[model samples]
Target chain A: MEQTSILETRHLTREFKGFVAVDDVNLKIRRGTIHALIGPNGAGKSTFFNLLTSFLKPTRGEIFYNGQNITNMPPAKVAHLGMIRSFQISAVFPHLSVLENVRVALQQRLGTSFHFWRSTRSLDKLNDEAMHLLEEVGLEHFSRVLTVELPYGRKRALEIATTLAMNPQLMLLDEPTQGMGHEDVARVTELIRKVSENRTILMVEHNLSVVSNLSDTITVLQRGTILAEGDYATVSANPAVLEAYMGSSAHD
Target chain B: MSINRILFWFTLAVLALTAPFMVYPVFLMKALCFALFAAAFNLLLGYAGLLSFGHAAFLGTAAYLTGYTVKDWGLTPELGILLGTVAAGALGFVFGALAIRRQGIYFAMITLALSQMIFFLAVQMPFTGGEDGLQAVPRGYLFGFIDLNDNLSMYYFVLTIFVLGVGLIYRTVHSPFGQVLTAIKENEPRAISLGYQVDRYKLLAFVLSAALAGLAGATKTLVLQLASLSDVHWHMSGEVVLMTLLGGMGTQAGPLVGAVLVVGLQNYLADLGSWVTIITGGIFVTCVLLFRRGIVGELRALWKRSF
Candidate 1:
């Protein structure tokens, strides 16, 4: 195989008080592939995403990004190195206009984020580029609207647009289609597929249809452990995966 | 700027230029000083979403330092103000570093605790004149040519500094730095995930707000020729908060309007003595209950709805 891993975890483990949220689990994500992690509510998918993004520190484990140890790196530094994550909740600068939301991500690269004396007009140069990103997500029509007023689905699109502005090497989307209507789920699923063309995407998705539609590889986690790892068909057909989702009766 | 904004600023500039003739220049100067102070506080609370209950530390520190430098060291008024502002900025740097590690109510409590420490230091420091403070500090010449001793000259001087301070704030609020601050306020985790060091931005905002508050304090000391214990009291910090809350926390003009209303009320209600506090509290209650966005915030919202 010509594929190389873009991210790797070495026995990643996180324990909460006495309960292990993410048990010792080693996982690898191939470069430029859409990999989905699916698990029930208590299966620790959120905790795994948090640990991967450095939002939560693992009790014991190391994270390697692009083959370099990033276990101790800060979340912002992790993001700066081209690994950005989206929230389980829709995250957009609520009061800012949709266009301003994308412009801010682009503005960070100019090294003037700390220049207090300069007028915001300096950011006007990014307007065209921001609009281009918005257009990509089909949010150009809502550019001038405040993000807080956006519909749930549109807000998710705006989140992706901002993530796209970062041009990340790896995008970790935590439940990108969570709580969306069927229409929104499909729209966002397609959007993810489009954005994943040049970037490796590691998403935690409960929507099995979205996973089956977009994931090149699928990993099933059950109670902080990997229950199955393979392509959609192989993982779905696995008895353990079936029992985890259903009950032991299904396997019997 | 929009037509209405230009017109509004033009009106404000004209009123400020001519107000000393109609109203007492001293009273106007006092209001301007407090307005600047409130605006500075708003920068932290409103924009950065960090409620600092100890902002009076910055204000009072600058006032005392400016008073001492101008009175004892024989420094020029500008240099005195500069020293005071720089000292406050340094203090802000320290406070910000310590407090930025906390969030919400904990952050507010830490600032209040730190400021109480300063209040005690003010009481004990020999240079501070204790409760007597530094009184009768001369308003030295502007560049040794224009005498600030003249009330008219002093009024213009205070006015000029107030304008410059507010202008700097306006620029900051509309700048890239301000944008990041707003983002941090709106969502800290998202900002961090977007590769922004949110704590660093919060610290810088804290320092800028402290320095600006110091500038207001130094100017107030010059206008009144006194730096007293009242400046550093926790009450003063609470009053600044009231001013910002009354005006509107995040809006550009909210704190300014709040400061004027507050200072003006205190002046007119001086005959009531201790009752003034009660009346002020009543007004605050009313503002919060009826128009929680503050006067300017409500007005902006109304305008947005209407137009």
Candidate 2:
């Protein structure tokens, strides 16, 4: 109910047949902050993200965005409400030029996505804006290259650029750096930090170092429920949180 | 468009303009109609990545409607074609709305089932003339002025429509709308997460393609002077698919070339009887095994590599 909270979930629960993937849980993401959700494998991080974006229906509970109930809003309509998301894997239009990839996102704002009779040349108006997004992602040089030709790290960066094209207020990034070298990880980490300004980011990151570096708040989940919630120092030092990560019998 | 591409189209146009002098106009008109049908099918398959196995419904429905209107109602050729095209579009909207929820082979099967339903209806419908078909469909005057009675004048009329249909396809492919369709084809989920109403885009593309296919069917009814059950048969749907795939599913000129080649073989090899189907099947299999992108696609790849 806090005014600063841009997104809030109450008792959100999702079950796959008999298995509960995302248990009854309450969470809040403050405006203009980077919040990271971390857990062990199969901890329901993805399911929770899917539920938040309404890509998956919650068995029980409600989601509120900016004080409006958006529990069952369609994914595209949610996106139109400025809550954009990136995939766990790099998702780009492989055959389109990198510039065209950004342009597709920008084109939605033109209210002419259905105008089959209009020439694509009219899209030239968005070229400068699209290039600026590319430049922000450090991909201006590769704008003309087919997206499939980009290196793995660059593709993730392009995904970010496309997401940014929406000028979203809230961004849900599912493993933005899931598979990358140290160099790519650092570059994407920095890019995320740069783009996170004046926006709210909810990320599911596996890398502890990246989590410790970027997250303003960290929530740890175990068995589809939050085990601990605090700053890195506080949560990392929690005995139960350590038990979840390092195992219960580590000291015994 | 590139200068080379423009020149290529120009060359083709010149050839088409002068071809009737050396070849039969009726045969050429037949090829042009099939080419238009194949091109419309390609718009869904190649660009939108939807494979509808029931496209003949649109073609057949339009053909029959145009035939009835022109023959019995004495409507002008243009009005009959327009009515047919619009009816086909409505039918497409229904089919697309139902089928788009499924994908890949299932989508194709849904279309095939719908087309078969139309085919049986055609067999029983009174106005369709049953097995004998609605024959003696007069070409009628163009716009109540220029006579389409003469074969040459009729050929010109058909040619103009073919160019406009193909030009519209070209424009649709290169338009902003086309970009979204391509995006949906490449990655449907990604297109949705990026805020596109993916289903709506797919439906619109389907309807536009169906209308164009219907236009071809309606025009053919006038040219052939008959609206037959064969036009709406499942075989007709399959033929358009084969033409598109053999021509090059996504290429601009692939369907046109494929239609001409197939129609030419069927005409010239008429004495061979059922062997024409066998030969066409053999070529299709060969094309799939060797150059899967079809003749035009393979040639373009070769030109790219050599240059």
Candidate 3:
């Protein structure tokens, strides 16, 4: 069966103070595929993600998810529609126990009302589901530990686990392995791969090696526009992409 | 499994229950009410990181409503309190939505402005009885059986509500919703990227805080048999913030301790008249400058270091 487009954007443009941060960009993400958005620091990758997730409204554009126009929808409504985004920085609730963090997301997804008299612990199914997600992310052993106590890499993993509890049909991850050691990067990479098996994964990554190894399609962005878009090999050889990265390589 | 945690809570509960016997019943009751108010305030400031300068609006509104219902409308104490709580919740829904539109110092200022409006209304409104306030409020009967006219009875009633309110706050903090609020407080941009509706979480926290503040204020009016302008004043809002800060910002038991200490000081210095304000101001300055972590926060730090 031909895979359907899980997320698409048409002529998405976001401008701040008359300067186009993301100009006339179009994107199509296939279901059950890992799509990577690669770009230089100022190429508006973050702004693009913000627009898609409804964090920032686009100056002009249309966004569709599952064949419904969700342009400029609030973040919560978009999330309830089965599209979720994970931050580059760990966004886990630090004071809450690891299990509680996931449980909170699950509660939102489960449509549990916040009733003062009712005890949430009585909801055995929610707890079990949260634990299952934690196990999937390999953080089950740390379930009772407060999220703030978790190591940096494990905190990132917990964030992914929390997102899974939401049961999103499409996941947007921003630089999942941005600041990690080699071992941690590899572990998160594996975790992302496993998660992508169940949902459409779209990520912004600067790590070329990880992007080349994991992405089914790569979209290169530079100067608020698409530099190239194709499979890794095709995009890597593209003159525009080479020029975008090569010019910045000297500084590193 | 955790013996220390269990023992710690047990000890604290014992101390709280025995407090009325050792201290003046009225003072204890006042402290209990303020503790509840402070805890409610902490829900917004510590957990959600949304500083509200208008918390007094909720407290004072609830106090006035409860006083009116019980005194003029002849409603039962429980029903009157419920009306007060509901009124605060309604106010919270509106104010929280509007206040959350801004962040940081802007949020604080917006809340302050809104609260100041309430203060003006209270002063001008005849129902508030002008400067004299709604006085001689009857404690009435609890459940139409227990006589609250008795001092001991009133003390126990206030204590029960205080305990229940604190328990509710504790449960909320441990719940998933509370965790999400904390995440929003710590890093709003990050929480939004996580697909969490950060503003909604914040508004929810604010409402919860307001409702609890209402509960405290209503209970206070019954205990003291009056609802006065003192409850509606901006100073009341500042006092609650000082209590929470002195106890601890994010720690579970911090607000309670702070409320007790502040109330105890007020009682001891009651004869000093306006000097009490100067002393409290000095304490606030001292806490902010020298002991920013607060008494409970410092203790927690020391405990952690030792362990």
CA lDDT of every candidate:
0.94, 0.94, 0.86
Instruction: Please provide, for model 2 over B82-192, each residue's C-alpha lDDT reduced to its tens digit, 9 standing for 90 to 100.
Output: 999999999999999999999999999999999999999999878899999999999999999989989999999999999999999999999999999999999887898
**On DockQ, who's better, 2 or 3?**
2
Q: What is the DockQ of candidate 1?
A: 0.91
- Model 3, position B204, has a per-residue lDDT of 82
Could you report the DockQ of all the candidates, in the order they appear? Answer: 0.91, 0.85, 0.36
Highest DockQ against the true fold, candidate: 1
Model 2 TM-score? Answer: 0.97
Task: Identify the leading candidate in terms of TM-score.
Answer: 1
Can you tell me which runs of candidate 2 are displaced by over 4 Å?
Answer: A247-252, B1-7
Error of 1 at A30 (Å): 0.6
Cα-based lDDT at residue B299, candidate 2: 98
Please provide, for model 1 over B41-113, each residue's C-alpha lDDT reduced to its tens digit, 9 standing for 90 to 100. 9999999999999999999999999999999999999999999999999999999999999999999999999
Model 3 over residues B1-307: C-alpha lDDT tens digits?
A: 4999999989988986787688788888888899999999998888888889999999999999999989999888889999999899889988999999898899999999999998999999999888999999898988999899887888888888888888888888766576567667766765665566677778888899999999999999998888999998999999899999999988888998899889988999999999998998898788878778898998899899999
Clash counts for all predictions: 0, 0, 0
After superposing candidate 3 on the true structure, give the runs of residues whose Cα lies further than 4 Å from its correct spot. A1-3, A250-252, B1-21, B187-196
For candidate 1, give the docking quality class from DockQ. Answer: high
